[model samples]
Target: MSPTPSPESMLPLLVDYIVAWVLICTILFLGAQRLKAKIQFYAMQSLGLSVLLGAIGLAHQNTKALILAVVAAIGKCIIIPLILRYVKRRVPMNKGVESYVAIPTTMLMGGGMIMAAHYLTNHLFYNQSHLFNEMLSTGMALVFIGMLVMMVRKKAFTQILGLYVVDNGIFCLTMATVFEMPMIIEMGILFELLLGVLVMGILVQRIHDSFQAVTLDELEQLKG
Candidate 1:
């Protein structure tokens, strides 16, 4: 006789999890209306990712996942974004609205890139019993898209937010597994992110002083 289905076989929970994934994806693709809105969206995406990670952790009953869920939700999702908001108020970048690639065009291209990623990387060489294994691939795609945004965008501040998005995508995948990335390793990643953003701010100021504009196209002289 066939065995009784495990509680994990519940269809509603699977539906909810997929819905969470879709909701986070939507947040990532949402349009940025202003610098403040952009910060808010970044924060929202981080928060949503934390919750999703935590929910997945609870489903899997992994203690390490629980720890990651708490720390990430508080440290990154809550604290970093508040600091970014304050920084945003100080800098007040209007350049984010003036992306070099027009908004609609960027959105269309971003969607296409996501489709291409699925086509290229969705092929599995082994069994997919572990949920983290699936997340690793999608998380890599999300990180790639975030980097593409940073590369294509002209505004320094927008790129900073993309940096956070990329960081979160990779970090989420890291947390999904039992592998505990050492405390030093985590701190080093944080240090790099902070240093990179600080350098970006300095560069933005120099750009403003030199060109009276923030668009990177103004640095055309730097290229051969």
Candidate 2:
């Protein structure tokens, strides 16, 4: 008879699911047309990433990883989304996010990016375990997707959301590989991200107030 699978044995599988959830959220973020929907997707992605980190922490009995997970959930999933919503309310702009590229084309590019990420990870970490490679590749793919969003989306708010995605991706990479970053370093990163978001939010509001639009193309008139 086959032996029952222990929780310890099942951890890698659970991590796979959590990582998949994060990737799915990124795809949803890419496909979503409305600004609010994209923001919500980013929040969901953050929550999923936190879960992944927590799972890894628990598996290894690492206190720092667990604490980082909670901080990530609170900062990324809750605070950032609230700030984004507030910015949305303050800014006068179209409800829908304008894309420089068509949805299908963007999705194709995203798929290609994922493939590229996988290739890069495989080349760099050929000695790593398969699960580790998967996690790292997915994390890198999220980073690429975030950059794509920033490039294709017209609104400053959506660009900020993309930046959040990029930050989450970096966190994922760290959690997957190191599994335990120093508390001071993590705190500094969190503070930097929060400060950046606040500054960007203020800049976005000011841009809207001064230029009457928040789209990069619109803001480019000031480049002179």
Q: lDDT values of the candidates? A: 0.61, 0.80
Count clashes in each candidate, considering only residues at least 3 apart in sequence or on different chains. 0, 0
* TM-score: model 2 vs. ground truth: 0.84
- Compared with the true structure, what per-residue lDDT tens digits does model 2 show for residues 65-109? 788788878988898788778777766668898889997788888
> Which residue window of length 10 is worst by lDDT in model 2?
179-188
Q: List the residue pairs that clash in candidate 1.
A: none
TM-scores for all predictions: 0.70, 0.84
Off by over 4 Å in 1: 1-6, 10-30, 124-126, 179-224
lDDT of 1 by residue, 1-224 (tens): 99875777753355346535633553454356566676666666667667766776677686766676687778676777676666565564563455677777766766765566555545652454445445565556567768867877777667776777677667655644445554643653575467457745755675565455444555665663
What ranges in model 2 sit over 4 Å off? 1-4, 180-204, 207-224
lDDT of 1 at 88: 64
Per-residue error at 149 for model 1, in Å?
1.3
